[model samples]
Target: MSEAPHRDVLITGIGLVSSLGEGLDQHWAALKADGGPRPVVDRERFAPYPVHPLVQLDFDRQIPKRGDQRQMEAWQRIGTYAAGMALDNAGIKDRTDILSRTDMIVAAGGGERDIAVDSALLTDILAASDPGRLINERLSSDLRPTLFLAQLPNLLAGNISIVHKVTGSSRTFMGEESAGIDAVRTAHARVASGQSEICLVGGSYNAERLDMLLLFELGNYLWREDWLPVWQRLSRGGGLVTGSMGAFLVLESPAHAAQRGATPVARLDGVRAGRCRRGPGEATAIARRQFDELVSGLTGGERLAVFSGATGAQPATSEEQVFLTSLRHADNHIPIRAVGSIIGHGLEAQFPALVALAALAVSHGMLFAPLDDSGCEADGSAPIDRVLVTQWGHWRGEGMALVAPAG
Candidate 1:
């Protein structure tokens, strides 16, 4: 028996909603504006810690039903909306024949908590004789049944299914940034290996929540005081400022896309994901290995740029900086842009968002301006035919993907 022939995976559609705003044109305009883009941050709301907040969206445009909107939490709504946009962008929103077979791979984190219920429980538990019992009692009585169901990470996938009708085999991943890396990897591999024809893959993060802020602050992973570019944050102990973003991509096999007459945004040449002990030089080594494998397959001399998902979280960010610097020293002086500096870190959604931006750049035939004054980012006026997107998770996981213009 002969093995199935491999196919090329092409990114046909992209739906992105972040601090810069929604859709490809809006984000592209913001990043390519004459004076360079200004970070759309809210420092007073979250206080000390600044965040890139999502722009106002009319839910009715994507999610029409009021009942559907009422049932979903913010993250679910964002994901579902983005998924719909991806389908629409791919010109298959109402094409039941195509959507019926579109697979879905979502990278998500646990849902937002009910802060009021949590506050009351904490207050009461502190005064109760049996704190454990008090907590259980409050959880059972104070929390609504629907709220618990809403908090499940898979609900994002469920909502996407219900709202957008992408009801093919659905899988959801939950490990922070790595989850995102694996989601895109799985989607690309499935399409390229003849396992699936098309896939809807991505995730969303709501960084404006109090619970999320408190959670990361507890880990001492948040920067205090005002905002700074991701690269500059390293000078003063690095920290991550989470953002509210939802990113989704419609990936299709080249044959399938051509058969349907769908245009390609970019070619997803390769994706490599790995993890290692946080020992010195370990993360950089993993990234170097991944970078080598991804680029080894490419025919040389393409003008390249990098879209780095370097969350301003210490040690990891510093290590990634080292790896990027080494790329420059190795005579591969690709211009680098740490995307987290603008949109802020979206955790599970971060990788997909960066990939979307890379696709936009390659499709446009140019790279956006440098995001920071930190000498790490240099201006690149040359045409970019290929882009390398890197994601080094704040705590663990390292991954990279090669995106190039579709022939």
Candidate 2:
């Protein structure tokens, strides 16, 4: 860490892909539109469990080589593609001189599961008189040894390095939503502290697979049948609808970006992440502390807003609401956009996605229409100056980030 003076961290570029669409322009257009098409969501695809499916993309645009795209699973391809988009957005994709120095920090979950093997094993287990032996038989006979290796979480970063030529120091973190929060947090800290000049950080998730839905279904954490606004899902046990998305960000020191003639989208003021046991008021308390600390740095109210990574899961989402309501009581009146209402839950990628959306809102000098007319989310009128991004994971982890206009 540098002691002389920490550099200001700027969001020099952002690359986001979600059910909304690919690229920032598509997302902005979809969000700001008044009453045309609603957010992209599919109800009948997985039946009972409605999901926000990703749009069909031409992978060759970002990932030029057919071989590179073939080696990766859906999540890896999505991440590699988005990473290239970030580099291009920063105007450094072709500048190998700068890319060789760009560090990368990725937050990722496990690779996609093999549903066929799982289903066969389950079927054998149900029919066999000796269930344990049947399970072992399927594990030995049906599963390929190489299958697990292909799903390694770090492969996302590895694929990015191979496909995009970003060869600086690389790091990967895995822990669901907190992984995302800390990925951005660490990248900002590195830039601000002079440990690194520029960093590419984010993650991706493929939620369309039955494996992910089944994983959550086992835990009773999946929304059923009809799709509803995140705020309105409480009536049906408050579960989440999965969305496939890849979110990557280019973070650079203010001096570094200016030196390279790169335009910054917004300034990252602060980020704080923590964990709270599922106790009564633990998550809310930690969240409010982070919110107050981050908001203290803003110069004025200036239509400040919060883009929340609420998973529509119980306890965490409700506690986050408590924190927001507390802010309102203090006259902060910072409106919130439950981003999951639009993009669904991307788990490990949720926090970064919200941060991306927050930066976009501030850069555009306006926030989109209220996601729901419910009293919780208020419409945005004035241009945004400072925005807060909040994340409370389904099981644990509470995080916050402040993205403000680049001076």
Candidate 3:
């Protein structure tokens, strides 16, 4: 017997929600406007710490039942809704046959904690003479057992399956930025190797919460005081502004897409994900290697563009900029857009978001204007035939993906 013929993977649909707004049209309009209202940041609610909040969404459109919406946490709701959008965009939302065969891969983090119960328990413990006893009582009586299950990372995948009829094999990855990168890599490899024909891959992050804000501030990673575009934040303190975002894409083998008459936004050439030990300039070293591999047969010049997912976290962000500058100086002086500057960092959702944006840019045959002004990202207009999306985690991972016009 011969090995199955290799397949070409294409990004056929996208569902993205962020501070820039919901859907590709809104985000495209904002980016295409060039320097319109910059990314919407909420500096008041979280005080000095800035966050990119989610746009107001009528949940009924995708998540029809109030009961379903009520049980899921914000992140799960966001992800499930985005998956619905992707299915709809691919013209398969109601196609039971395709929906049954679609494999789902999600990148997610542990579920949100119950803030009210936590606060009450802490407050009561402070007033009680027997603090330990009081805590034990509260643990058994106040906390619901299901709360633990609610926080499981896999719940996002479960919710997506229940809300939408994606009944195929399901898998969820959990390591922040690295998780998102690996999820896309798996989806692309599966489609390319003929292991799977259609796959939905992506994740979500909710940044407008007190618990997450406190969590990041513990590491001094939250941008304080005011909002600066990601590239400009280093001058102030160099911290990341988390965003509420949900991004999902429908990937299908070229043959599968053609059979269904589905239009592809772009072709997924390859995805490379790896981690650096953060040893002296290792992020850039890894990125340089991955960049070289990703841009293999592509003509270098203005026709190629780079979309960066650099979180404003120090050292890493600065290091990535250095790599981009190096690429530019090396005659790959293509247009660069640090998307985090516009929609804020989405953690596990960030890389998928970049892939979605890159596909849209290639599909339109144009590059969006620069979101940076520190002379780091240059501005230009070009009919982009290829795009390289990159991300360096605040602490460890570095990844890249190459996308091109679908032939």
Candidate 4:
């Protein structure tokens, strides 16, 4: 007896909301515009620490009920809204039959902190002789049930289920960038292995919050003062300029999509992830091994484009540069684009957003222009058949994926 053939996982729909704007057409137009895509930086709002703030959106367009919108925090609302857009794009928004079986996997961080209550508590602590008691009293009284419930990371998935009616088996991952990578890897594996016919997978980030900024600042991970492109930031002591964004994708087996006459945006050929200690060159070695495995049998003649999720943070970003250099030397100079330069880093949402961009490039048959004058990016005029997405987390996690045109 012969072994069964492998199933193909197709990306049928993508929903993206970032500083560049919302949806597929908006992003494509912004990247392909004649002026080469201006970075939408909010230098005044965050002041010294520049950020890419999300454009205003009408929540009623996706989340019909005001009551539902009122309960979720900003991150949950963004993820729910993006998830609804994905279902709509997949042409199955109201199809109870299909939605009843669609699996969901979300990658997210803990809920946003209530800045007002936190500020009041901190101020009162300075005057109180018993700071510990004051803190405890405030925690017991000031934290409401709804606010406490909102802090759960899984609430993003719950909100998606409540708003979109995707009541399938749900899972959520909580590590930063690695969480996003694993979410996509798990979704792709399940559908490709026939365990699931379809899956909705992705994550979102709220970068405009002061609490998040304070956390990163404590670790000295945030970029400050001037705004520079991702690649150019290395010279100024590399640090992350986080962004507010949400990204989601609908993945399905080829046979399942065919049964419903749904068109595919691109095919997810492979997904690979790894992690290592910050010891000297371990991250690059891990990435190299994953890259070799992901593109094992591809021919040298194939046109390849690379979408790098380099967050402009210290050693990780620098190490990713080395890995990319090796790829250029090995592949005779493949075009590379540092996506964070355009949209800023989205932490948990970074990987999914890059994958969505790769799928868009594959479907459109062209790569977006270089984002900076760092000499790392080059213009590509030839049609592209495959795109490689790379992610090196600001601290740990290394991952890569291959995206190609759907047959």
lDDT against true structure, model 3: 0.86
Best-to-worst order by TM-score is: 4, 1, 3, 2
TM-score of each: 0.96, 0.94, 0.96, 0.96
What tens-digit string does per-residue lDDT give for candidate 1 at 1-407?
Answer: 11223878899999999999999999999999998877899999889889899999998999999999998889889988988998998998978898899999999988778788889888887889999777667666786645554348898999888888888999999999999999998888889898999999999999989998998999899988699999999999999989999999999998899999999999998888898888998888888888888787656677788899999998899889988977766655489999999899999999999999999999998988888998888787778889999999988999899898988
Model 1, CA-based lDDT: 0.89
Q: List the residue pairs that clash in candidate 3.
A: none
- Residues 297-379 of candidate 3: C-alpha lDDT, one tens digit per residue: 67535377889999988878887888898877776457788899889989999999999999988889887777767987776
Question: Scored by CA lDDT, what does every candidate get?
Answer: 0.89, 0.85, 0.86, 0.89
Local accuracy of candidate 4 as per-residue lDDT tens digits, 219-320: 889999678888899988999999999999999999999999999999998898888996889988888887787787688778888999999999888878
The runs of at least 3 residues in candidate 4 whose Cα sits more than 4 Å from the true structure, single-residue gaps closed, are 1-5, 144-151
Evaluated at residue 286, the lDDT of candidate 1 is 83
Supply the TM-score for candidate 4.
0.96
Would you give me the overall lDDT of model 2?
0.85
Of 1 and 4, the candidate ahead on TM-score is 4
The TM-score obtained by model 3 is 0.96
Q: Show model 1 residue runs off by greater than 4 Å.
A: 1-5, 144-151
